[model samples]
Target: MPIKLADIAIFIITLAIIVFYSVTTLQKDSNSSYAKIEIDGNTFIYPLEKDLIKTFHGPIGDTTIEIKNGKISITESDCKNKICIKMGKIDKLGQAVACLPNKLLITIEGESNDEVDILSY
Candidate 1:
Protein backbone atom coordinates (compact mmCIF):
# COMPACT_ATOMS: atom_id res chain seq x y z
CA MET A 1 0.00 0.00 0.00
CA PRO A 2 1.21 3.57 -0.84
CA ILE A 3 0.55 6.71 1.17
CA LYS A 4 -0.44 9.94 -0.58
CA LEU A 5 0.91 13.46 0.18
CA ALA A 6 -2.30 14.41 1.97
CA ASP A 7 -2.03 11.35 4.20
CA ILE A 8 1.53 12.24 5.22
CA ALA A 9 0.48 15.79 5.99
CA ILE A 10 -2.35 14.58 8.17
CA PHE A 11 0.02 12.27 10.04
CA ILE A 12 2.45 15.16 10.70
CA ILE A 13 -0.35 17.40 11.95
CA THR A 14 -1.60 14.69 14.28
CA LEU A 15 1.90 14.14 15.61
CA ALA A 16 2.33 17.83 16.28
CA ILE A 17 -0.93 18.01 18.19
CA ILE A 18 0.02 15.05 20.35
CA VAL A 19 3.42 16.48 21.11
CA PHE A 20 1.96 19.86 22.10
CA TYR A 21 -0.65 18.28 24.35
CA SER A 22 1.89 16.08 26.10
CA VAL A 23 4.35 18.89 26.67
CA THR A 24 1.73 21.24 28.04
CA THR A 25 0.24 18.62 30.37
CA LEU A 26 3.61 17.58 31.74
CA GLN A 27 4.69 21.18 32.24
CA LYS A 28 1.66 22.02 34.34
CA ASP A 29 2.56 23.04 37.91
CA SER A 30 0.07 23.19 40.75
CA ASN A 31 0.90 26.43 42.55
CA SER A 32 -1.48 25.77 45.44
CA SER A 33 1.17 24.75 47.95
CA TYR A 34 0.36 25.41 51.58
CA ALA A 35 2.05 27.96 53.83
CA LYS A 36 3.98 26.35 56.67
CA ILE A 37 4.84 28.04 59.94
CA GLU A 38 7.43 26.67 62.35
CA ILE A 39 7.70 27.94 65.88
CA ASP A 40 10.05 26.37 68.38
CA GLY A 41 10.36 23.31 66.12
CA ASN A 42 6.58 22.94 65.82
CA THR A 43 5.16 22.98 62.29
CA PHE A 44 1.78 24.34 61.28
CA ILE A 45 0.39 24.13 57.76
CA TYR A 46 -2.29 26.31 56.19
CA PRO A 47 -3.66 26.66 52.70
CA LEU A 48 -2.42 29.82 51.02
CA GLU A 49 -5.79 30.28 49.28
CA LYS A 50 -7.54 30.64 52.63
CA ASP A 51 -7.66 34.02 54.36
CA LEU A 52 -7.14 33.95 58.09
CA ILE A 53 -4.81 34.89 60.92
CA LYS A 54 -3.05 32.55 63.29
CA THR A 55 -1.13 33.29 66.48
CA PHE A 56 1.83 31.08 67.22
CA HIS A 57 3.86 31.05 70.38
CA GLY A 58 7.52 31.63 69.67
CA PRO A 59 10.52 32.30 71.89
CA ILE A 60 9.67 35.93 72.58
CA GLY A 61 5.86 35.65 72.52
CA ASP A 62 3.00 35.36 70.07
CA THR A 63 3.66 35.76 66.37
CA THR A 64 0.66 36.53 64.23
CA ILE A 65 0.63 35.10 60.69
CA GLU A 66 -1.91 36.30 58.19
CA ILE A 67 -3.00 34.76 54.88
CA LYS A 68 -5.01 36.84 52.50
CA ASN A 69 -5.49 36.70 48.72
CA GLY A 70 -3.24 33.68 48.39
CA LYS A 71 -0.36 35.44 50.12
CA ILE A 72 1.16 34.77 53.53
CA SER A 73 3.05 37.13 55.83
CA ILE A 74 3.80 37.90 59.41
CA THR A 75 1.57 40.70 60.61
CA GLU A 76 2.75 40.85 64.22
CA SER A 77 5.75 39.45 66.02
CA ASP A 78 6.82 39.79 69.59
CA CYS A 79 10.47 39.45 68.68
CA LYS A 80 12.41 42.62 69.35
CA ASN A 81 13.42 43.26 65.75
CA LYS A 82 10.13 42.23 64.23
CA ILE A 83 12.12 41.06 61.24
CA CYS A 84 9.67 38.34 60.39
CA ILE A 85 6.97 40.91 59.78
CA LYS A 86 9.41 42.94 57.79
CA MET A 87 10.05 40.05 55.43
CA GLY A 88 6.77 40.85 53.67
CA LYS A 89 4.32 38.50 51.93
CA ILE A 90 5.13 35.39 49.93
CA ASP A 91 2.95 32.89 48.11
CA LYS A 92 5.30 31.05 45.83
CA LEU A 93 6.70 27.64 46.74
CA GLY A 94 10.07 27.64 48.58
CA GLN A 95 9.71 31.22 49.90
CA ALA A 96 10.26 31.73 53.63
CA VAL A 97 10.40 34.24 56.47
CA ALA A 98 12.32 33.67 59.68
CA CYS A 99 12.77 35.36 63.03
CA LEU A 100 15.78 33.89 64.74
CA PRO A 101 15.13 35.50 68.10
CA ASN A 102 11.62 34.05 68.21
CA LYS A 103 12.61 30.64 66.80
CA LEU A 104 10.16 31.07 63.95
CA LEU A 105 10.40 29.89 60.37
CA ILE A 106 7.60 30.43 57.88
CA THR A 107 7.81 28.68 54.53
CA ILE A 108 5.81 27.64 51.47
CA GLU A 109 5.87 23.84 51.35
CA GLY A 110 4.69 21.34 48.71
CA GLU A 111 5.86 19.36 45.71
CA SER A 112 6.18 21.48 42.59
CA ASN A 113 3.74 19.21 40.77
CA ASP A 114 5.72 19.51 37.60
CA GLU A 115 7.13 17.16 35.01
CA VAL A 116 10.35 16.33 36.87
CA ASP A 117 10.98 15.89 40.59
CA ILE A 118 14.78 15.71 40.66
CA LEU A 119 17.10 18.11 38.88
CA SER A 120 20.80 17.36 38.56
CA TYR A 121 23.32 20.12 38.91
Candidate 2:
Protein backbone atom coordinates (compact mmCIF):
# COMPACT_ATOMS: atom_id res chain seq x y z
CA MET A 1 0.00 0.00 0.00
CA PRO A 2 1.21 3.52 -0.82
CA ILE A 3 0.72 6.50 1.52
CA LYS A 4 -0.74 9.68 0.05
CA LEU A 5 1.01 13.05 0.49
CA ALA A 6 -2.03 14.45 2.28
CA ASP A 7 -1.99 11.58 4.75
CA ILE A 8 1.69 12.16 5.52
CA ALA A 9 1.05 15.84 6.08
CA ILE A 10 -1.81 15.06 8.42
CA PHE A 11 0.32 12.62 10.39
CA ILE A 12 3.11 15.19 10.76
CA ILE A 13 0.69 17.84 11.93
CA THR A 14 -0.82 15.50 14.49
CA LEU A 15 2.58 14.49 15.79
CA ALA A 16 3.58 18.14 16.12
CA ILE A 17 0.49 18.91 18.13
CA ILE A 18 1.08 15.97 20.44
CA VAL A 19 4.69 16.97 21.02
CA PHE A 20 3.76 20.56 21.71
CA TYR A 21 1.10 19.57 24.21
CA SER A 22 3.39 17.13 25.99
CA VAL A 23 6.20 19.66 26.35
CA THR A 24 3.90 22.35 27.64
CA THR A 25 2.29 20.06 30.19
CA LEU A 26 5.64 18.83 31.46
CA GLN A 27 6.95 22.36 31.82
CA LYS A 28 3.93 23.45 33.81
CA ASP A 29 4.13 20.45 36.13
CA SER A 30 7.82 20.89 36.84
CA ASN A 31 7.39 24.59 37.53
CA SER A 32 4.66 23.94 40.11
CA SER A 33 7.03 22.57 42.76
CA TYR A 34 8.67 25.93 43.40
CA ALA A 35 5.38 27.47 44.51
CA LYS A 36 5.22 29.57 47.65
CA ILE A 37 2.57 31.61 49.52
CA GLU A 38 2.79 34.76 51.59
CA ILE A 39 0.08 36.56 53.54
CA ASP A 40 0.09 39.66 55.71
CA GLY A 41 3.24 39.86 57.85
CA ASN A 42 3.57 36.11 57.91
CA THR A 43 4.93 33.92 55.15
CA PHE A 44 4.05 30.27 54.74
CA ILE A 45 6.87 28.21 53.40
CA TYR A 46 5.72 25.36 51.26
CA PRO A 47 8.67 23.04 50.84
CA LEU A 48 6.82 21.26 48.02
CA GLU A 49 9.62 18.75 48.48
CA LYS A 50 6.69 16.39 48.97
CA ASP A 51 3.22 16.34 47.53
CA LEU A 52 1.11 18.62 49.71
CA ILE A 53 -1.71 21.10 49.49
CA LYS A 54 -2.36 23.85 52.03
CA THR A 55 -5.24 26.29 52.38
CA PHE A 56 -5.13 29.63 54.18
CA HIS A 57 -7.88 32.09 54.98
CA GLY A 58 -7.57 35.65 56.15
CA PRO A 59 -9.47 38.94 56.35
CA ILE A 60 -7.80 40.18 53.22
CA GLY A 61 -10.80 41.25 51.26
CA ASP A 62 -12.26 37.92 52.29
CA THR A 63 -9.85 35.88 50.22
CA THR A 64 -8.49 32.37 50.58
CA ILE A 65 -5.19 31.08 49.35
CA GLU A 66 -4.81 27.53 48.22
CA ILE A 67 -1.56 25.69 47.63
CA LYS A 68 -1.95 22.31 46.07
CA ASN A 69 0.00 19.82 44.02
CA GLY A 70 3.06 22.03 44.22
CA LYS A 71 1.15 25.03 42.87
CA ILE A 72 0.09 28.07 44.92
CA SER A 73 -2.84 30.16 43.82
CA ILE A 74 -5.82 32.13 45.09
CA THR A 75 -8.70 29.70 45.43
CA GLU A 76 -11.59 31.89 46.58
CA SER A 77 -12.47 35.43 47.57
CA ASP A 78 -15.49 37.48 48.58
CA CYS A 79 -14.32 40.75 47.09
CA LYS A 80 -16.57 42.59 44.62
CA ASN A 81 -13.88 42.20 41.98
CA LYS A 82 -11.77 39.06 41.92
CA ILE A 83 -8.62 40.80 40.80
CA CYS A 84 -6.40 38.70 43.06
CA ILE A 85 -7.73 35.53 41.56
CA LYS A 86 -6.75 36.81 38.16
CA MET A 87 -3.19 37.30 39.41
CA GLY A 88 -2.72 33.59 38.80
CA LYS A 89 -0.17 31.32 40.54
CA ILE A 90 3.15 32.24 42.13
CA ASP A 91 6.08 29.80 42.47
CA LYS A 92 9.05 31.89 43.45
CA LEU A 93 10.52 33.17 46.69
CA GLY A 94 9.85 36.88 47.31
CA GLN A 95 6.58 36.59 45.39
CA ALA A 96 3.50 38.18 46.92
CA VAL A 97 -0.19 37.65 47.48
CA ALA A 98 -2.26 40.74 48.11
CA CYS A 99 -5.90 41.71 48.57
CA LEU A 100 -6.23 45.42 48.06
CA PRO A 101 -9.78 45.70 49.33
CA ASN A 102 -8.79 44.31 52.73
CA LYS A 103 -5.36 45.93 52.79
CA LEU A 104 -3.65 42.56 52.99
CA LEU A 105 -0.24 41.88 51.54
CA ILE A 106 1.73 38.69 51.54
CA THR A 107 5.35 38.53 50.54
CA ILE A 108 7.70 35.55 50.37
CA GLU A 109 11.09 36.18 51.91
CA GLY A 110 14.22 34.12 51.57
CA GLU A 111 15.33 31.91 54.47
CA SER A 112 18.72 33.52 54.75
CA ASN A 113 19.96 34.28 58.24
CA ASP A 114 21.71 37.44 57.14
CA GLU A 115 20.93 40.54 59.15
CA VAL A 116 20.58 44.08 57.94
CA ASP A 117 22.21 46.94 59.84
CA ILE A 118 21.46 50.60 59.25
CA LEU A 119 23.92 53.30 60.23
CA SER A 120 22.61 56.77 60.92
CA TYR A 121 24.91 59.76 60.62
Candidate 3:
Protein backbone atom coordinates (compact mmCIF):
# COMPACT_ATOMS: atom_id res chain seq x y z
CA MET A 1 0.00 0.00 0.00
CA PRO A 2 1.29 3.48 -0.91
CA ILE A 3 0.56 6.55 1.24
CA LYS A 4 -0.21 9.85 -0.49
CA LEU A 5 1.20 13.20 0.62
CA ALA A 6 -2.39 14.54 1.04
CA ASP A 7 -3.20 11.70 3.40
CA ILE A 8 -0.18 12.47 5.55
CA ALA A 9 -1.11 16.17 5.69
CA ILE A 10 -4.70 15.43 6.70
CA PHE A 11 -3.59 13.08 9.46
CA ILE A 12 -1.20 15.66 10.85
CA ILE A 13 -3.83 18.37 10.81
CA THR A 14 -6.36 16.17 12.61
CA LEU A 15 -3.84 15.22 15.24
CA ALA A 16 -2.96 18.84 15.89
CA ILE A 17 -6.60 19.81 16.29
CA ILE A 18 -7.23 16.94 18.70
CA VAL A 19 -4.24 17.86 20.80
CA PHE A 20 -5.26 21.56 20.95
CA TYR A 21 -8.81 20.79 21.96
CA SER A 22 -7.74 18.32 24.65
CA VAL A 23 -5.37 20.82 26.24
CA THR A 24 -7.98 23.59 26.23
CA THR A 25 -10.68 21.39 27.74
CA LEU A 26 -8.42 20.15 30.50
CA GLN A 27 -7.38 23.69 31.41
CA LYS A 28 -10.97 24.87 31.64
CA ASP A 29 -12.05 21.97 33.82
CA SER A 30 -9.12 22.30 36.17
CA ASN A 31 -9.69 26.04 36.64
CA SER A 32 -13.36 25.74 37.49
CA SER A 33 -14.35 26.68 41.05
CA TYR A 34 -17.47 26.67 43.22
CA ALA A 35 -19.32 29.96 43.68
CA LYS A 36 -22.10 31.70 45.54
CA ILE A 37 -24.60 33.89 43.72
CA GLU A 38 -25.43 37.49 44.42
CA ILE A 39 -28.23 39.34 42.68
CA ASP A 40 -29.55 42.87 43.24
CA GLY A 41 -27.65 43.31 46.50
CA ASN A 42 -29.11 40.02 47.82
CA THR A 43 -26.98 36.98 48.39
CA PHE A 44 -28.29 33.57 47.40
CA ILE A 45 -26.43 31.15 49.62
CA TYR A 46 -29.21 28.62 49.42
CA PRO A 47 -27.01 25.97 47.87
CA LEU A 48 -24.58 26.27 50.74
CA GLU A 49 -26.85 27.20 53.66
CA LYS A 50 -30.09 25.36 53.00
CA ASP A 51 -29.09 22.69 50.51
CA LEU A 52 -31.80 23.97 48.17
CA ILE A 53 -32.05 25.53 44.75
CA LYS A 54 -33.72 28.84 44.00
CA THR A 55 -34.74 30.50 40.79
CA PHE A 56 -34.73 34.16 39.76
CA HIS A 57 -36.92 35.60 37.06
CA GLY A 58 -37.50 39.01 35.52
CA PRO A 59 -38.44 40.80 32.32
CA ILE A 60 -35.68 41.51 29.87
CA GLY A 61 -37.21 43.32 26.93
CA ASP A 62 -39.94 40.63 27.04
CA THR A 63 -37.52 37.88 28.06
CA THR A 64 -37.51 36.23 31.49
CA ILE A 65 -34.45 35.22 33.47
CA GLU A 66 -34.28 32.10 35.61
CA ILE A 67 -31.46 30.87 37.85
CA LYS A 68 -31.27 27.71 39.90
CA ASN A 69 -29.03 24.97 41.18
CA GLY A 70 -25.51 26.18 41.92
CA LYS A 71 -25.73 27.71 38.49
CA ILE A 72 -27.55 30.49 36.70
CA SER A 73 -29.48 29.79 33.55
CA ILE A 74 -32.33 31.15 31.54
CA THR A 75 -35.49 29.13 31.91
CA GLU A 76 -38.07 31.24 30.09
CA SER A 77 -38.08 34.43 28.10
CA ASP A 78 -40.17 36.40 25.64
CA CYS A 79 -37.42 38.07 23.68
CA LYS A 80 -37.62 37.77 19.95
CA ASN A 81 -34.01 36.61 20.25
CA LYS A 82 -33.17 33.71 22.56
CA ILE A 83 -29.47 34.46 22.91
CA CYS A 84 -29.67 34.29 26.68
CA ILE A 85 -30.86 30.71 26.59
CA LYS A 86 -27.99 29.82 24.34
CA MET A 87 -25.50 31.25 26.83
CA GLY A 88 -25.97 28.06 28.88
CA LYS A 89 -25.35 27.27 32.55
CA ILE A 90 -22.58 28.91 34.59
CA ASP A 91 -21.39 27.51 37.95
CA LYS A 92 -17.85 28.80 38.35
CA LEU A 93 -16.65 31.86 40.18
CA GLY A 94 -16.77 35.14 38.17
CA GLN A 95 -19.59 33.61 36.11
CA ALA A 96 -22.57 35.85 35.52
CA VAL A 97 -26.29 35.89 34.90
CA ALA A 98 -27.20 38.92 32.87
CA CYS A 99 -30.33 40.20 31.16
CA LEU A 100 -29.31 43.28 29.26
CA PRO A 101 -32.77 44.67 28.73
CA ASN A 102 -33.87 44.13 32.32
CA LYS A 103 -30.72 45.59 33.86
CA LEU A 104 -30.22 42.41 35.87
CA LEU A 105 -26.79 41.07 36.72
CA ILE A 106 -26.00 37.98 38.76
CA THR A 107 -22.38 37.36 39.72
CA ILE A 108 -20.81 34.29 41.25
CA GLU A 109 -18.29 34.78 44.07
CA GLY A 110 -15.74 32.07 44.70
CA GLU A 111 -15.24 30.60 48.17
CA SER A 112 -11.61 31.64 48.13
CA ASN A 113 -10.50 35.11 49.15
CA ASP A 114 -7.05 34.73 47.64
CA GLU A 115 -6.53 37.14 44.79
CA VAL A 116 -4.38 36.76 41.76
CA ASP A 117 -1.60 39.36 41.74
CA ILE A 118 -2.23 40.32 38.16
CA LEU A 119 -5.92 40.94 38.83
CA SER A 120 -5.15 43.76 41.25
CA TYR A 121 -4.42 46.20 38.46
* CA lDDT of every candidate: 0.80, 0.58, 0.55
Each prediction's number of clashing residue pairs: 0, 0, 2
TM-score order of candidates, top first: 1, 2, 3
TM-score of each: 0.67, 0.45, 0.43
Clashes by residue pair, model 1: none
Cα TM-score of candidate 2: 0.45
Ranking of models by lDDT = 1, 2, 3
lDDT of 3: 0.55
- Which structure among the candidates has the greatest TM-score? 1
Which structure is stronger by TM-score: 1 or 2? 1
Q: State the lDDT at 65 in candidate 3.
A: 40
Which pairs of residues clash in candidate 2, taking residues 3 or more apart in a chain or in different chains?
Answer: none
Which parts of model 2 have CA positions greater than 4 angstroms off? 1-61, 112-121
Give the Å shift of residue 23 in candidate 3: 36
